[model samples]
Structures are given as C-alpha cells and as structure tokens.
Target: MKKSLVYLAVGMLIFTICLGSSLITNQAKAAEEYKISVVLKALNSDYWKSVKAGAEAAAEKYGVNLSVIGPNNETQVIQQINLLEDQLVKGVQGLVVAPLRPQAAKTVLEKAVSRDIAVITIDTDADFEGKTSFAGTGNFQAAEKAGKYFADILAGQGKVAIIRGAAGDYIHDQRVDGFMQGIEGTAVEVVSVQPADSSRGKAVNVMQNIIQSYPDVNAVYATNDEMALGAERALKSANQAGVKVMGFDGSPDALKSIRNGELTATVKQDSYGIGYTGVELMVKHLAGETVASEVPVPTFIIDQNNVDASIRDLTKAFSRDRLEVLFGEDVIAEVFAE
Candidate 1:
C-alpha cells in the first residue's frame, strides 16, 4: 500500500508538471503578436503607396506586425504569386492581397486558408473560395457615374474612345461593363476600344493612333487616371480640340489636372479608407471578432466643381506638404498640369 501511494504521488506530480508546461506554452503563444501581410497588385503608383501608408498606420494603431509588398507593376502576375507564396511559407497569421489576376492567385490563397491563415483582399476582389472578405471600391458603379456624366456632357451625341487597362482584370471588366450600361440607349457612339494595359506611355501611343484613325473622336474615357493624363498629352500634342477626358481614380495628379483644366473629370475611390479598413478588419478577425465579408468604400467624381476640396482631402490623406518637400512644387505641378 505504501509503495502504491508513492507511485501514485509520483505520477500525479509528473502530470501536474506537464500540464503546467503546456499552459505556459499556450500563454506564450497567446501573447505573441500576430504577423500580418499586405500584398498589393503593385507599388508603382501614388495610389498604392498611399494604401501602404494606411495599412502601416492601422498596424501601428492595433499593435500588430505588418509587412507590405507588391510587384514592380500590375502586369507581374507570376511575381505577385511568388511573393504571396513566400509570405505563406513565412507563416503569416493573416494576409491582405490585391491580386493582379484573380485566378492566378486563387490556388495559393486557398492553400493559405487550408492552413487556417486568414485572407483579406483589398483594392481588388478575388474569387477564391476561402477569402475572408474584400475591401475595395464599387468600380462598376463609379464607372457608370462617369459614363452617365460624360454622356450628359456630350448631350448623348458624340464619338468617344475607350482606353482600357489590363485584360481579364475583374475590376477593369466591370468598369467597361458599367460604362457600356451607363451609355446604353444614348447617341454617344463608342468609336474605338484599345488596350493600353494601364501604361501611360502605351496610352499615349494608343491615343495617338486612335486620333489618326478617328479624328472626330469627341471624348476619351480611360479606365485609369494615368492613361487619361497620357491621352490628354497626346491630344495636346496633336492639337486635337479639347476632347473631354474622363478618368478613374482621384489620384493627386488627376486632381491637379482637374484644377489646371487638363482633365475634365475622374472618379475618385477611397484608397486610404480601403487600406485602413482592410488591416482593421484583419486585426478584428484575428481577435476572434466577426467581420463583414464585403466592405465597399465609396467613390465620387472629381471635376472642376469640387477638385479644390478634393485636393485638400488628398493633401490631408497623403500629407501633401511633405510630398511637396520630397517632390518639388514644380514637379507636382508638372505631373498634374494640362
């Protein structure tokens, strides 16, 4: 009986030690800060850089470790996938991505989900099965607004050309579809549709070619502000009569262009809001809170009527005073000028 009691006591002590050690290990894991990653389409534009700033701001606010990376340009599908896979291998607790191409990254995102890593999409939505949520603009509605405004300005009777972004991009397709829907049953005839792949130089070349073929083109609607600005430059060079230029993304350059009467109008998506909300939602999700599956930021048209207010808002969002110091006033003016 004494021997039996000794054995029982020894086993109980060992079991207590093991339980204590397990508890300690679990507590350490619970205390460890979550590492989150934000993978964007690319960091090539002011818009994306602003998104990075917003995400970083949120990470700081919520006490999470955050990493942001992207390809050199939007066309780097393979590069983007490789970067995402690298983040997965690093064991990020959560992920936010703006996929260059949806299907290309779907498999990798699914793998991440399988590993129980939370995935959120920003700026662009992915059709992945296990995506936690999407934080982006309603590109279709915004494009529709621009199209209807353009049609009204043209009095529903004019020749227009469209400069498109990357082919097969879901956002771009929706924008095109929305524009078509907005202009349906109107006399505004869409004369030319060309793919610039969202490159400013390519847009310039394409716009120049369109002018050569359709000299009477009354307006040009570009899927993005960069292309719109490039088209404007091409029009100016050819001395084409002020063909109304409409663009998307209320980029700083675009706002400045509106101020200088270079660009007729542009639809401004809430880029900062999208980035901040994406990280905020990820943090909430990591904390075991329920979050909406779709978060759509608002967008509006910025034209001469409200361009000044838009500039003020952007200055606040992007820290314009600092940007001016980094990139001189002349550079700012030139980039946004007519």
Candidate 2:
C-alpha cells in the first residue's frame, strides 16, 4: 500500500506539471497579441470619420485591439501631443498618427520609441524625427500634380488663386509649395494666397475676397476638400459657374460635386487606407517584420469622367481592397515603401 501511494503521488505531480506548462504557454500567447492606437486630425470632417471606421474594421479583422483619438483640427498640435503622452502612459504596443505639426509631433514620437513602442506617421511627414515608418500622400509630388492638373484644365492661360487651409502646418505648406512649383513659369498667374483656416465658412469668405480681387480668376485651388466645396458655393452664389476648382481630400462632398460637374477636380487622398495601412505596418513592426522607413500613399485626381464610376462603386464602405480599387494599389504600396 505504501508503494501504491508513492505511484499515485508521482502521477499527481506529473499532472500538475503538465497543467502548469499549458497555463504558462497560454499566458505567453496572450501577451503576444498586439495592441495599438491611432490618432487623427479630427472627427468633425467626414474624411476622418471614415478613417476611424476603417481603422476599426481592420482591427476587428486582424484580432487586434485599436483605440483612436483626434484633435479638433490639424493645427491642434498641443492637444495631439497631450493625447500621445496619455497613450504612452497607457503603454500601447504601437502608435500611429497624422501629426498636427510634424516638428512638434517629433518629440512625442521620440518619447514613444524610447519606451519601445512602435511609432508610425500617417498622412503627414515627421521624418526629421525618428519613427518606425510613415504612410501618407507624397504631399509635395501630389501638390505638384494638382497644380499641373489645374493649369492643364485652364489650358495654361488664366488668373488663378490659392486658398490654403493654414500657414505653418507641414501638410498644407507642402501642398502650397508643390502647387506653386507645378505652375512655375506657366502662364497661369497666382493672384492671391488666402488662409481658409479649413472652415467651410472661412473658405467661402476667403474665396469671395479672391473673387472680388480677381474677378477674372479662371482656376482656384483650395488646400482641402471642405475648403474646395466652400469655394464652389461662393462661386455659385455669385452666379459664376465656369471657374474651375481643384481641391484636395476626396471627401464624399467633393466626389458628389465632381459627379455633378461643379468642382473641376480634387486630389483624392486615401485616408481610409492611411488608417488601415498604418495599422498593418504597426502590426508588422510588432511582429518583428522588416518594413520600409516611409510609405508614400499616392493621390488620385478626380474629375467628372471618373467621379461617377468611383462613387457608384463605393462598396464595403471601408476595406483596403476596395480602397485600392477607389484610390489605387500603388498609393498604399508607395506609402509602405518609404
């Protein structure tokens, strides 16, 4: 009976050891699940609202935890910085942001990286500071393309005005510079540069001022979609329908206007893909995969010809595959390549 008792004890010991090993393995696997956070400019704009939806969808599909935050506008640098500081305190696995200001956002990136959290920039460039990667429109190149698009639409001989959203923000600045560079030595003369503050009302007021200053203005470029639509309303209110308007950010309003032939063109940014690819890159960094240092998501110039087709086929509401079809695969691929 003593010998039988010894055998039973050994069996019990083996059972406990096996159970403990299984528990440790499960716990370690749980730790491997990646957690991430995404920051945007604001939810006030439909562009960012759709971006949040896409981020959530990607998170659900990938079995990852994602939390999103945004400031009231792209210029809200301090608020965005504070938001990042909070996320850092929470110890997220990765952080993705479209900086309110690239230089200002740099410090936050450095801080997050020092803590070993993967940092990725989306829809903006903060490369002067260290980051694992970035995915955004090649703002400079895209702006250049947009400028040329405007000049071409105007047939290269017309007075044009530029309505910029804000002055110091890198994204808007790069866009303005690109547009200027595109029209360099062209007959299209730049008559004005007005700050729209990215408000629809502000854009309308600025656009009206430009119209008053240059009634002969043949083309206009609003730095963002909302501003562009505002310019269109101003032109329409004055009974001026022939002035070609090119805006950035292919928001739903912009697309619809393009379909209606009001806004001449818009450089469509893949914001949804920005959110999704940003998350995917964060996942890759977390998974120990080698990723590019910068990703340049390309931009699309929308006009009447392609607007209806693109908008009509807006399927899945938000998906990377569908975004590629709407924006183009080269966009997000270029973003990751950086």
Candidate 2 runs further than 4 Å off = 1-32, 318-338
> What are the lDDT scores of the predictions, listed in order?
0.87, 0.81
* Worst-scoring 10-residue span by lDDT in model 1: 329-338
Q: Which tens-of-lDDT digit does each residue in 169-274 have in candidate 1?
A: 8888888888888899899999988889988899999999999999999999999988999999999999997799999988878877787888999999888888
Write down the TM-score for model 2.
0.83
| RMSD vs true structure, all candidates | 8.0, 8.3
The pairs that clash in candidate 2 are: 293-338, 294-338, 295-335, 295-336, 296-334, 296-335, 298-331
Task: Tell me the TM-score of each prediction against the true structure.
Answer: 0.87, 0.83
Candidate 2 local lDDT, 25-101, one digit each (tens): 76456435777999887778868977777677677766687899998886677888899899998868899887878
Alpha carbon deviation, residue 16, candidate 1 (Å): 29
Using alpha carbons, what is the TM-score of model 1?
Answer: 0.87
